[model samples]
Target: MTERILDHPVLGALEPDQTVTFTFNGMTYEGRDGEPIAAALLAAGVRTLRHHEESGTPRGIYCNIGHCFECRVEVDGQQGVRACLTPVREGMVINGGGPLPAPVRDWRKNHA
Candidate 1:
């Protein structure tokens, strides 16, 4: 996949950040170091982070301040992590476009 470029009229050509490789939904992608996973995914043109378990509805980043769980994704073997809150790390494995288990929803309800 090609790396995304954002050219802002006011910002002009901004210096690129250091990038790290991470996998999203079995496909490899690059993300900037120390940035939010959602930001990285958005930059990479990933619009659907996960699907609703029951309705199979697509969901992506919303209420970026971490108030919403719309950006939940699976990292490594762990599930239901908020992409908006989690920083992208080198070699991180992100699994998107899947259903959240019941335990994940229960945990989010109590903790999020």
Candidate 2:
């Protein structure tokens, strides 16, 4: 089942929007153009956008707003783009966020 609310008691039936295809983790999926990436991904049954850098815990949409960074994902070669705020564009190359890079021998201490 899709996550969209097609027939709302207050809004009635909703018309289908233009569908756009985008790549997420090398897989193509359809979504409404200009809709939030998080919404589209959720509709596609993608609950885990990324895993926690340190804990390896799965992470997905939390606040559904632009404030939280939990829904961050890579888009068009950029990292840490908020999926909840970023609009889904056709043919966009998106890679789900991954674990943070391990510190290289604690360079901060050496540099200090």
Q: Evaluated with lDDT, which candidate comes out highest?
A: 2
* Residue 20 in candidate 1, Cα distance off native in Å: 0.5
Which runs in model 2 stand beyond 4 Å of their true positions?
102-112
For candidate 1, the per-residue lDDT at 55 reads 54
Error of 2 at 35 (Å): 0.5
TM-score attained by model 2 = 0.86
Query: Across residues 4-88, which tens digit of lDDT does each residue of candidate 1 receive?
Result: 5667688777578898999999888898888899988998888899998745689998899898898888898788899999999
Candidate lDDT (C-alpha), each? 0.85, 0.87
Assess candidate 1 and give its lDDT: 0.85
Candidate 1 runs further than 4 Å off: 1-13, 100-112
Candidate 1: deviation at residue 25, Å? 0.5
Task: Write candidate 2's Cα lDDT for 54-111 as tens digits.
Answer: 5568999999988889998999999999999999999999887665556733554367
